[model samples]
Target: MGRRSLSGKVVVITGGARGIGAATARALASRGAVVVIGDLDVEPAKETAAAVGGSGHALDVTDHAAFSAFLGSLGQIDVLINNAGIMPLAAVTEEPPETTARQLEINLHAVIHGTRAAVGIMRRQGSGHIVNVASAAGKFGFPNGSTYCATKFGVVGFSEAVRAELRGSGIEVSCVMPGMVRTELISGLSEIGFLRPVTAEAVALGIVRALEKPRFDVFVPRRLNALTRFQRLVPRRLSEWAMRVVGADTALFHGASSAARAAYETRVHG
Candidate 1:
């Protein structure tokens, strides 16, 4: 596909305050996409929106009503980026109920709601794109991030289904999966991973590419696709054994929430 132009396109990124959202919002704005920063944090969202000279709205992904209202406020959106999510970092059996619920609300449910709202407008307009920011968790399902994996998997599945359903509708949906990104998500990693945690800027550019080409699925860097394919092919027994031996689950648990972080800190530091 050829490099597509983003001039005058309107993009709505759900978690536009920091990390990937902020980076993507900026990247798109620079390329001619009028960005809309919607986040729970007002100051950060406003800052990013102002930087892009677009717009910002303090909105929570999980709040269905508020999210719909916020979408309505934006008038017409050419692109919708579902990027808000959380990793609780707990063994499935040991995971807290609240943490799991929170992850589901933000990750899976929010994607569904956003797609629903976006589809209505996009289909009517007959030209739009949706980008769901999933994770390598959706592909590999690392040890302690089971719930997080579940949600991302749901996103991937949802995106595929939506794409099939909207066959000739000009509206497109893409699942943008990123691997071990170097961001707040992995605060303590410092710099060690299968591939040095990729930068937000790199991820942002990948998203922009996806919008221009309108693919149903977009993997970051375009290189991780093969690795993800290999991860899926490994026998389950071997995969679990290797993960346990390497303490992968424990690492994910610690990488999640502050409560999990505290517990993880005690275990790793002890």
Candidate 2:
């Protein structure tokens, strides 16, 4: 199939205020698409919209009413990008119920809710694209990040099911599994010592590529895809051991906070 052109397409993106979401909005708008951006932060949303010459609205992806209203306002959504998420560090038992719930709400349920809302509109139009931003963690579980992994894995699974369900419907669903991308999410990791990163622009570039090709899944660098696959095949015990040896805290996915640092200090000093 010939690649689809983004020209004149109507795209809606969550987390569009900054990071990958903002970059994606610009990327699509640059291709002449009309973009409707939704973000919890109105200031950044306005800035991104101004830069891209598109529309921006304040929204929390977890709120069903807010999401519906955002979509209702657009009336037509050609591309839907579910890009809002948060990672808070916690051991399984250490995580507050609220933290896990919020993560599930934003990272997982938002995708479910967005897919439902967008599909209804797209099915009516008979043409659209849905891009759900997942991560390498989605493919292989990380210790201390079990909840985060579960949510991202749910994204991959949900995208697959709907993609197959929507086959030949003039609508396509693509899951973008990005590795480390330089974004504000990093601020959540100040206590962490290691840094491996990719720029939001680069991740955005990969997303645009995915949009054109409409692939089932997109992994930035492409090579990382193989590494994730290999990781998935490794025994859980061995993988966990290797992760500890390298000081690769799976908790990194949940993210670090001053509070978390204080807790760690208490544990160490006590």
Candidate 3:
């Protein structure tokens, strides 16, 4: 299919202050999309938006009323990217209840709320796209990241069901599953063989491609899609062995105590 033009499209991105969200905002703007950034960090979000000739707003995605108001303020919504999330690594048993709740609220519930709001607007217009940023951990569980993995897994499943629901409504839904990305989210984490960390720009490009082509599943580095498919068909024991070989089993566990991750961990924990 021919690529769709992003020119003049009004795209709304949550968590656009940094990382993949900021990268995507710049990329879509380069394609002539009028990007609107919404982040908890209003100052940085505005800075990013100013650089791209877009606009920024204070958005707390976890609050339904605030999220709805933020979207409603936008005149037209061509695309909505639910990108706000936090990852606080810890063993499932050792994880605090507050930490688990925070992850669920930010990572999964917020996506759900934003998607539903976008659907209402898109249904009225009869055209739109929703991109949910999940993770490769959503496809396979890893040590010391059980809650984080659960939230991502929920995003993957939720996106699939919503995609099916919106099949003929002219509103496309994409689930982005990226491997360990070179962002603060993966600070202090070591690369696991060939599953090395991908750049935030690379993930942003995958999102851009999804917008242009309207694909349902978007995997950064692209190879992860195939690997995940293979993992699904293999025996459980074999898949477990493969994970061990690639160091996925202990990457997050070791990263938890790394001094490099202290600041990011502190921010997320608070």
**Judged by lDDT, which candidate is best?**
3
For 1-270, candidate 3 gives per-residue lDDT tens digits of 899999999999999999999999999999999999999999999999999999998988888999998898886999999999999988888889999999999999999999999899999999999999999988989888999999999999999999999888899999999998999998887776867889999999999999999898899879988889879899999988988887888878766788888788888876
lDDT of 1 by residue, 1-270 (tens): 686789999899998888999999989998988999898888989998999898888888888999999898788889999998765566779877777788889999999999999999898888899899998677766766788899999999988899899888988888988876766667654333444578899889889888877776677767678766655689878767755554554556443556535653343221
Q: What local distance difference test score does each model get?
A: 0.81, 0.80, 0.92
Comparing 1 with 3 on TM-score, the higher-scoring candidate is 3
Runs in model 1 lying further than 4 Å from the true structure: 232-270
Angstrom error at residue 136, model 1: 0.8
Q: Tell me the tens digit of each residue's lDDT in model 2 across 94-184.
A: 9778778888998999999999999999999988899999987687666666788899999999889999999999998889887667776
- Candidate 3, clashing residue pairs? none
lDDT of 3 at 201: 98
Where does candidate 2 clash, by residue pair?
A: 87-254, 88-254, 89-254
Candidate order by TM-score, decreasing, is: 3, 1, 2
Q: Which 10 successive residues of model 2 have the least lDDT summed?
A: 261-270
Error of 2 at 114 (Å): 0.7
Find the 10 residues in a row with the least total lDDT in model 3.
248-257
In model 1, the clashing pairs are: none
